[model samples]
Target chain A: MRNLHTDEIIKNIKEMCIEANYKLASDVEERVRGAYDQEATALGKQILGQLAENLDIASEDSIPICQDTGMAIIFIKLGQDVHIEGMDLEDAVNEGIRQGYEEGYLRKSVVGDPLIRINTKDNTPGIIHYEIVAGDRVEITVAPKGFGSENMSRVYMLKPSDGVEGVKRAVLETVKLAGPNACPPIVVGVGIGGSFEKCAVLSKKALTRSMDTSSPIEHIRELEDELLLEINQLGIGPGGFGGKVTALGVNIETYPTHIAGLPVAINICCHVNRHVSRVL
Target chain B: MDQYINTPLTMDKVKGLQAGDYVYITGTIYTARDAAHQRMYQAMEEGKEIPFDLKDSILYYLGPTPAREGQVIGSAGPTTSSRMDKYTPLLLDNGLKGMIGKGKRSKEVVESMVKNKAVYFAAVGGAGALLSKKIKASKVIAYDDLGTEAIRELYVEDFPVIVVIDSKGNNLYEIVLQSS
Candidate 1:
């Protein structure tokens, strides 16, 4: 078995955090560029132009794209053939986040307690998700999530009878409710067919997928396209000022579910949907 | 044409503004968000002095990242304004002329704006890097303990914003939503 050190993980995570904040993923950038060209309203176009300019400034100057550098979210695909050595994996990951936030001058938004609400200072204790694979290589993805859209996210526990129409209704309702709030020209990540919490996690995972990529599942792919058209038709526009391009892209992910339930979760993200991935 | 406005915005100036007007504001403004708002509201309730002047003042709902070396401030932009809805009416009642933030405010906050003759402005959310260049200077005025959420007095030059809700409670977001 190939051996991997936590130090390597720590180093990569730290750099990935900085890179994700400074430069948005290319897929997201491309979609925003495409949206800018297609947007109809003058106000919406101006807002989109400013957003594009903001992206340029962020990378050129080596500062974050948005001030809310967001909580660290890491997804790891660890190979079962690889053996990890050094500190506990979780602590090592948190160490990476601490160093990243400190060194990169990213905001420390985490609170130690829900009620007391004290800043953790170091931006530690990241939300990490792991999956074991067959190969010896490890793949890591970092997506720093801003809360403006996170607060607008929703989960629906529909009966089996609800079906695709129910899913459409739920997603449309969430987007309408989000309106100007989710930072329109938003990226919508949708998860379908799982337990409640599982679907929620899946929705967040969906946001990591490249905007140009569609789900491998045939029916799900069609659903993604249809939803994208329907959402833009809502005229939420860029910055929700009313125009044609409401969402940059819609990504849907699904898993097998229990016979009785059809759970759906919608995780919305702003124009600055910061995500970066690396493999080692 | 974008209206060029100077801060310390009065009721008369605010009244002249209309919903959907693009404005570039210069001069002085203060930053305060969740924690700072709570403290300031409690102080107002107890009849204690707030850190900054209340009359004709503008408060921006922002919580910026720490400045890097040689930088005036880090990527600074507007945060979600709806979160501050709880304390907004009180601030409006106390001679506040305008607020800078993103997203929708509550019905009560809008009503308070009508009564107090204040306007609510929104800078494009997530445009922090572009927005920071306009803030020529920034100094934390009070509540340093609140970290990023602290009250920072800022001198801005041509800060871009759109009037979302005007003094008479005319709303830009409402019209956009209806038309859509």
Candidate 2:
């Protein structure tokens, strides 16, 4: 078994956090530019232009793209043949986030307690998800999820008979309800067929997928395209002012579920959809 | 059509604005979000003095990131306005003449704007870095313990916004819906 040092993991996580906040991933940037070119309304075009400029400034100045740098979400794919050394995996990840937010001058948005509501100060205890995979190298992805869109996400457990139409309706409704609040032109991430909680996780995972990538399954890919078209037709547009580019992309992820249920979740992401991955 | 206006908005100035007019505001505005609003509303109920003067003042629903060295402020942008709907009418009654935020305001809040001759403006959401460039200066005016949620007094220069709701209850959101 290949032995991996915890220090390496922590170092990578810290860099990922800082870089993801400072740089809009190239795919996301390209999609936003595409939307800017396609947008019809004057206001929509102006707003999209500003968003592009903001990203450029953030990269040039090493500043955050948005004030809400968001809570750190770490997704880990640990190789089954590798053993972690030097520290506990979760502790290492949180320490990385604490150092990253503090040193990068990113906002520390986490609160220690939900109801009591005290800032965590250093943005610790990153939400971490781990999976053991077949390879010997570890893959880590850091996604800084801002609450504006997170609060707008929805999950529904549909009856077996509701089918694809129900999934479509739920996604459209979530986007409509989000309106301008969640920041259009938004990214729509749809998760289907899992249990309730798993479906929500799947939807979030869908957000990390590249905007240019489509689902490998033919029918699922078609659904994504259809949803993208319908969402834009909502005329929620850029910043919800009114235009033809309400959403830059629609991504859908699915998993098997029990025979009686058709669970679905919609996780909306704002235009500043920030995430980065590293393999070590 | 972009219009330049100064803060401490007057009824005539507000009346001149219609739904969808792009505006650039200069001068002072107060910043408050969920926590600060709750505290301010509670203080108002207790008859305690608020930290800043209220008459003809504009409040921005925002919680900016801490400014780095050599910067007046970090990325500062409007938050979702609906969360502040509960406490907005109270502030409006006390002469808060304008608010800057994003999203649809509550019907009650819109009515309060109409009754009080106030107005609502929306800055572009997710354009914080661009917006921060307009803030000339900022200082925590109250609730420093709340971190980003503290009430701040900001001096802004040509901060861009769109008039979303006017004193007469004309809402830009509704206008967009109808026209589309």
Candidate 3:
């Protein structure tokens, strides 16, 4: 069995949080630049230029890309053959979030209660998902999810006969409803075929995928391309003023489900879709 | 067309503006978001004094991140405006001449803008790092316990925005939707 120290996990998580907030991932930056070149409207081009400039400033000045540093969403792939020493895994992750938000000067957006909201102060208790995997190495991915777009996400439990067309309608409707509110040119993550909750989780996971990459499954990849084209055609544009680039990319993830149900979830992420990953 | 505007915007100045005009605003404005708005609306309901004077004032719906060492403010950008729709008409009626935010406002809020001769501006949301450069100074004026959600008085220089809704109830978002 491979033994891993808890401090290592905490240290990595802390670094991931700070770096993810301070710098836009290169793939995302590239996609934004590409969108800027392709955008037709004058206002859309100007907005995309400012977005590119913002990314540069954040990297150069070591400042956050957006005021809402977002609630930390951590995805962990734990090795079956590895054992953690000195702390509970979940506690270690939360400690990392607390330290990251405090030291990085990132915003503490978390509240203690849903109804009578009170600041959590240090942005603790990150949303963590775990999976047991085959190797001796652990892979950790951190995605800071801002609520502006998170609030726009939706799920539909479709009839077995509804099929692909239903999924398309649902995604378009969600994007249309989001309009300028969720920050266009957005990144759309669609999850299909799982149970309700599982589909939601899958949609979020799909968002962590790189914009430059496509789904390995050929049919699903085609669907992603088609959705991207239709969404951009909506002319939501950058900042939703009006243009040809409404979405930077459309990512779809799927799972096999019971024959009776066809579940789909859409998790919309803003242009500043910040995520970073590390393997140890 | 792009224009330069000064804060404490008057009805005359608001009337001169129209939907789709890009503007750079200078001078003082206040910041308030969900928690602060709720508190202010509650205070107004009870006939209590608000944290700042309302006449001819502009409010920006933002909750900026805390400043790091030497900076005047952290990434400051507009939050979604529709969330503030519930309390907006009250403020507009009380001589809040302008608001800075993004997204569509409620129909009632737009009507209130028309009735009160107010205006609504949209700052590019998620462009906080770029926007913060315009804020020359900032300090919390109320609800310090609310942290980022506190009401802040800010002195900004050439802060960029687009006129999304005008005094006549003309809406830029609707115009864009129709054209698209």
Deviation (Å) of B165 in candidate 3: 1.1
lDDT of each: 0.91, 0.90, 0.92
- Using lDDT, give the best candidate's number: 3
Sort by lDDT, top down from the best: 3, 1, 2
Q: Arrange candidates by TM-score, highest first: which order?
A: 3, 1, 2
Ten-residue stretch with the least lDDT total in model 3 chain A: A54-63
lDDT of 1 by residue, B1-180 (tens): 479988779766887899999999999999999999999999999999999998999999999988998888999989999999999989888889899998889999999998889999999999999999999999998999888999999999999999999988888888887887
* Deviation (Å) of A261 in candidate 3: 1.2
Q: How would you encode candidate 2's per-residue C-alpha lDDT over B150-171 as one tens digit per residue?
A: 9999999999999888899988
Report model 3's TM-score to 2 decimal places.
0.99
Return the clash pairs for model 3, or none. Answer: none
Model 3 misses residue B33 by how many Å?
0.3
lDDT of 1 by residue, A1-280 (tens): 9999999999999999999998888899888777778988899989999999999998887668999999898999999999999999999999999999999999999999879999889987799999999999999999999998899999999999999999999999999999888888899999998899999999999999988799999999999999999999997788877899889889999999999999999999998888888898
List clashing residue pairs in candidate 2.
Answer: none
Tell the DockQ for candidate 2: 0.75
